[model samples]
Target: MAEASYPEDLLYHPEHDWTKIADGVATFGITWYAQDALGEVVFFDPPEVGSSVTAGQSYAEVESVKAVSDVFAPLSGEIVEVNTALGDTPEAINDDPYGAGWMVKVSLSEESEQESLLDRAAYVASLT
Candidate 1:
């Protein structure tokens, strides 16, 4: 399982999604907290590329041994890439949530939506 960590360079949404932005694209994944809560992941049905996703919306779903949960979009964007590897190795979400588990990368559609996201400190604080 992934050790609990909230990377400093990333932003967080209250729904337990994390964001890593580079150029105009942003990568998204569930936080360590979200995966831990879900237990061992067994399936991940990712959205198709070229789809538009809005911030605070559910774009996909992850099924763990314990439950199925929606994967929320942390920013508004048009999807550019998806980690297809997760289809065969969904456990990567629990094993390396921030790395191998990244779900989607999107070309951001609304830059201003980022301001609503929390930083590492604020996100961790929200957990309390």
Candidate 2:
């Protein structure tokens, strides 16, 4: 695996999830560091669109050739959409964890929750 990159535009959970907020909705995905650790992702099991997800909780699962890992929610919200494309090409997670690998979009229950997440610098420091 190569050195992982954390984008400054996103907030991060210590568990290696990233959240991109926009217009009360948040896009969620596992970080590059996470996918590298998980190995080649073989499956993505996502929650339903109408389902709720709580901050600091697992909302879905990604199975890799090495193991199955829980994908955590970085904010509390109702799921608005899931990345169905992952069902066919799970390796997109390993290839593009921040872009094509994005798992879900959510309508946030508490916008202020964003304050609790780590910035890119902090997350990179945590990795060290």
Candidate 3:
């Protein structure tokens, strides 16, 4: 599993998801806390590229040696890209939860919704 970290550059969801937004698009992934909690990742089931994702709803699932966990969308959007690499190298999620482990890229449908997400400080605090 990845070393514990809550990157200050990304926004967080209470469910342990993170978002990296830029120019109306965003990359979504489970946070460091998530992969670590799930143990070694072995599978990633992603939504299709054109599928719509709703904030606070599960858009995909990640399976670890311990259990399968739903991956929530932190904002409403249409999935534009999926990390296909994870299909063959699921261990990347455990080795690099924030980098090669990212799950999808989406064209945002509601950019303003990002304001509701937690900042790193608040997210870390919530964990305690």
lDDT of 3 at 25: 94
Writing each residue's lDDT as its tens digit, candidate 2 over 8-51 gives 99999999999999999999999999998898899999899999
Error of 2 at 95 (Å): 0.5
The TM-score values for the models, in the order shown, are 0.98, 0.97, 0.97
What does candidate 1's lDDT look like per residue over 1-128, in tens digits?
Answer: 64699889999999999999999999999999999999999999999999999999999999987788999999999999999999999999999999999999999999889999999999999999
- Name the regions of candidate 3 deviating beyond 4 angstroms: none
What is the descending lDDT order?
1, 2, 3
Candidate 1 stretches with Cα past 4 Å from truth are none
- Per-residue alpha-carbon lDDT of model 3 for 1-128, expressed as tens digits? 53588899999999999999989999999998888889889999989999999999999999997799999999999999999999999989888888999999999999999999999999999999
**Residue pairs clashing, model 2:** none
Cα lDDT for residue 45, candidate 3: 94
